[model samples]
Target chain A: MSYEDEINQDILNSKKLPEKLEISVLRYFWQSNPLIGKKTDSIPRFLRKIDVLSNFSENELRILAKYLHLRKFQPGEVIFKQGELGVGFYLLYNGYADIIVENTEGTDEVKPSSKHILTLEKSDYFGELALLQEISIRNASAVSRQGCELLGLFKPDLEELINHYPVIAAKLLQSISLIVANRLFSLTREVQELKYKLSSYEKDQDASN
Target chain B: MPQISINTKRERFKLIFFISTLLLAFIGLAAMPRVSIPLLLGYVIFLIVYPAVPTLEKLGINRVGSIWIVFSALIFFSIYPFVKVVPTVTAEIENVQYFLPKIEKYVTKKYEELRIEVREKTSFEIGDKYFFQALDWIRKTSTNILLNIPKILASLLEWIFFIPLIIFFLLKDGKKFKRGILKLTPNSIFERFYFLSHQFNKKLGDYIFAKFVEASIVGITITSGLLILNVRFALLFGLIAAITNIIPYVGPVIGFIPGLLFSLAEYGPGTTLGAVIMLFVVANAIDIAIVFPILVSKVVDLHPLTVVVSVILGSQWLGMVGMIISIPFAAALKLIAQEVYKEIYQE
Candidate 1:
């Protein structure tokens, strides 16, 4: 297997965390948990390492963890499929998931692989477009390339969180803008490559004639 | 380049979309100030019905009874408070007269002292006529406001009496009301409207609940704190703070000014100064550090800058009531625009 494939497998095969630690790990995102006086020390550091919850205050990070449902996906588990009603934004807490976009021609334009598409590891996030717009389905599918730990934020919960915490909205906006910019840059590069390929093909045809 | 043209066209389209949304939002915001009694009643009634639906169902209340119970409760609770508070708050203006002579004397004394100090340092004359003229303008404005109370009260009572009946009818037929409106729309647009309606309801409901909870908590907290501090009029000041706290940023300041003035009046300047400083710090700290951040995180997610800007713009158009409705109204409009743009344009 390729090095990338090995990395994906390692993520999928990673051991589940201790049950006691699991709640704290989840607390890293949902800040509402401590309202009734549950305290955890380790969660904030863990959430800070994750890109999405990094901007949350120590208190807010705890609240965010309360709303998150952490789940494990084994290799090849379909996390979500294209055209599914968008509900939650996801984060790769551990392991790798492959993002696959299906084109109109029934072909998958894979970002990294023809079979599985792009593999993402820890700290990577997706499905943000779902949070912003209603009636819009997921544009792509995320299938676990290896065993993966993922965090999810359902639509209603996110809106509630945003309404309550303006700072979180600011952070999410920054993350979203970064994601959009990255996508635009990649698309520009692809277009440039396509143009280069078309020009070379034209030159080759002239020589052959 | 082909890419440049596509980018430019896309940019132009985005600009158009953004401008149209802003215009729609402004129109919606402007409508809020003029929401009239019936619509305001409808909004409050709609809110109570959602949470009460399950409870009412469990109690074997049908939709009509639920509507009656909700509307009746709203009238008893809301209108009763307004009736109780408006006359009392208006009567409290009579107390303003008791303080006015003291205030004028205080102002004159302060101005005389300042004038003496200024003359000792520099020859800048503040004319006596100019001071009296300014004082006269203040008295005129105050008297006008005082005189307008009865006229305002009459209109308010008329609106209040009609609101509950309107609320009852709306609650009785809300789902039907919604469906009937949608049925008027073209088939192609129904799905979008349906989605938009759901999104609006969800966001608006969440925002209102979060805000109500936050305001209640803040009010109780400040009231308890004031009681502990032995502040006079603790109940009234705390109540005002809690109600105005609904308006974001400016609410606490408005709450503090009256509290500070009373503190100054009761205690000498030094004690008043300390109390004012302490109140300002504690009240603002609790609001910004704890209440607002947590409340906002749960409800609308608008940027703080956006919230402040919206509040200022909203207040400019709608006055006090407009300011109260501004945040959620802005959020609801944004949700609608997002739903529309995505469903209509993208697809």
Candidate 2:
């Protein structure tokens, strides 16, 4: 079995804690990382180990850490499906995920397997498009390539954070915008190059005619 | 990007679906006040316990352990009043009932004397109805409260048992529960939701906490003062003061009269009344001096007229309890208004 398969098995084998302890564990993870809470290391140290959350201050990150829910996903599990409604954002913590776009013309939507567009590793953030739009749909499906631990920020969580600590929310918005702007700029360049190539090709065709 | 709400048809459809789901939930709630009451109580308890979770965690306790600690402390505090003050309040009610006829006679005599004096001076006999209307209202309110005492106790008992447990689960699964509710908001409205909810939470929580502290301080002060004066049912009178003090604008006046009457019953108008007045003055001073500073942010800015109207409406609807809740309710309404209007008309 692959390492991914092994991690998936480990997650399954993980002992279920008592309800009270489980709640504490969930709350602790959601509120603040236990590892970072002990003053053993600064949040930036841990954040640097992950991608995306780079722009936020240690103070802002501390507030964010307190509320972000760390979620687990198994290998072969679909995190979300293409064309499905989306309501939350995900920041990958560990393992890998396949960003897949379904072949809508032929295959079944419910089937696990799809065309993989890219592999997202640790620190890679996805599902942000869902956050930007009022009603969001997954353009590409996200499926775990291995057992993964993820930091999940649902819309409500962001809203609550925004409500209490708007400055931090502003910082988070800026981060997301940076990513979106980069993507938009790159896409604009690609489209410009494609348009130039197409026009040149058309001129050649005209000459042949 | 900030103003970008559900721009696409699909997003709008999602928002519509979510709103419809909310409408259905509201309908379900309206059909069941019994369930809704407990649910609302649970939500309120959760809100109170929510900030305390971090404190407990900071103290090196796990969430469950923290919740256990908070609940235990709450129970310990709550049981003191239940065991000590509740019986006193009940016994005082019986005493007040016994004194009702005598009190009525004394009031009637005074009313007739005032009416006679007004008739002689103005030569247009002002009806005793106008004079005694206030007394009648007070008498009716006290009797109503007395009659409903059992029901109030029953509800309080229910809350004591259920609220702690509800608070426990709420703190445990609060984020998850909130997420479930938030899932209903389409991204378009989520920002608006975020802004309004934050303002609402901060203002309302601060207001409630400040009021609670004010009440406790007032209760203790009045109770202590009355004890020093050797006044009867000092705890009961103090509790009354604290409760009425929660109602804005006219609360202190309402609270003062009962203490005056208690003093009147004990030592006539000479000694105890003077002591009572002095006690109130000192208590008000402390409130203005200390509590105001602590509650500067918590102060629910409302027009005096708004307060009076709300108080009257609240009294009409829910008696004294209604009156107490009405001021805060009006304040909350103001917050909602500010949120909606500000968002709607943003430059």
Candidate 3:
């Protein structure tokens, strides 16, 4: 047989029905195997739902997941205290966490009052500033509302990622920057609206006078 | 409220359990010197070479491939030296015994001459009691060390087999190991503990790397200079210089002493002695001037007094290894202290 004809013959032989069926069946079995495959697949699956990390590909997310630390917190447990140095950015992997801001002003130093800022649910992330800042201080404390699991990525992990996987690190940084930028944009808009309201209120008082 | 209390109690129990587990593991490791020593040695080597793996990975090789490359390169370089240098170093160490008696005799003769001069000058007898005792101590220690060479080499041969295995596994699975420990850390102290350990490890790695380079420079300079000067036992003296140079302020002087005495004994207090003295001075001057400022000081950042005190304490506790590790340990302590100070006073 000629070289091209020989190659065609080999391709035809390999494409026989039994070989294709066997390969597909083996792949299906491998994917469906709960003990070996599905356990490690959960983290990447969880990460896939995160809006900020949406930029990461499946492989990238898998690599990123290896760097994360899964921490379990008891109910009412303090994740971090206000004004404490923080080096970890954490994602709420499961359950809820409360962000609490303590009232720093006032003489009630011994029994300071705290205000609830927000309750973060699963897929929510906080502490991005910790990863970016040179000296990150917790402005508000994070406490587990009714027990939770957190996936934490610390400064050291980020540094390792940057060293070993610069592409993933850059994408992560970009996502964090996007989050910060969105928050800043909204904050500035709120400030502008408040300013306009204040000016109108002043005009109304002047007109009344 | 009752539930909260129960949760806190559980947390406290977990924290204590975690701490005790760590302590137990440390005690276990410390109890076995044969394993722990090589493990420690491998850890140090791992720290020194770990950065290269990441750098190689950045150049586009896969992690395992990079690890293998770095590992093979390390093995090749180390084995080349081991094969070539061991016999020469052993011979030199053996020859050093004969040279030590000559140095001792020279010292004794000088002391005698000094004693007579003092007696003549002041019409008072000079006691040779303490002087003779010191000479005796030196002679005994030198002989003991000469006898222990074989034992040291035997342990070294074991370490040769053990350390690379430890290093290879460490290089491969170090991240997984760190993660495993982090998983055990209590939630309350996790961030602080991780940060502290990370900083300490980085400081230690940097300090060791700096010290290694500094010692190599000093050792090579002295050895090559002595060889050029036709000094006997050049390699042995060079090795002594390198090893002693790991200690802080007193190290350079201690390293120079044997060479000084040897030259004085062999060549008298003349040109060769001057040349040897000059060689030590220049080598140390290079260290203090160029290497210390450039490499070591930046990594350690400890005050001279702190270095000296730590070295003293370390030598008291763990002898030579303690002295070698003291500066970095002190630096880590300073970091922890600073963190505590910030916590208490700043906020």
Candidate whose TM-score is highest = 3
- Model 2 alpha-carbon drift over 4 Å, by segment: A1-49, A52-66, A69-209, B1-7, B20-46, B115-141, B296-299, B302-322, B327-332
Q: Estimate, for each residue in B12-92, the C-alpha lDDT of model 3 and write its tens digit.
A: 898999999988997887677678778878999999999999899888899999999999999999988899888998988
RMSD of each: 20.6, 13.1, 9.4
Cα lDDT tens digits for candidate 2, B1-347: 01111236655687789879877996886577556566765665566556776666656677688877877887788799789878988998778777766666776776688888888898877766766788888789989978999997898788777777777777777667766765565544554554456556666667777877897898899999999888887888898889888887678778888778766655667977898899988997888788966783346788879989999998886566567667777887887788677656752
Q: What's each prediction's TM-score?
A: 0.55, 0.62, 0.90
Ranking by lDDT: 3, 2, 1
Model 3: residues with Cα > 4 Å off, grouped in runs: A1-37, A108-111, B1-6, B29-31
* Better model by TM-score: candidate 1 vs candidate 2: 2
lDDT of 3 by residue, A97-163 (tens): 8898886664755566787888999999999899999999899888888889999999999988998
Docking class of 1: incorrect
Count clashes in each candidate, considering only residues at least 3 apart in sequence or on different chains.
30, 3, 0
**lDDT for residue A204 in candidate 1, whole number 0-100:** 100
- How many clashing residue pairs are found in candidate 1? 30
Ranking by TM-score: 3, 2, 1
Best by lDDT: 3
Clashing pairs in 3: none
Note the Cα lDDT for every prediction shown.
Answer: 0.67, 0.73, 0.88
Q: Can you list the residue pairs that collide in candidate 2?
A: A30-A66, A31-A66, A134-B188
Model 2 residue B261 distance off true place after TM-score fit, in angstroms: 2.7
iRMSD value for model 1: 14.3
lDDT of 2 by residue, A118-191 (tens): 88898888888777787787798777775676676767667666756767788888888888888899999999
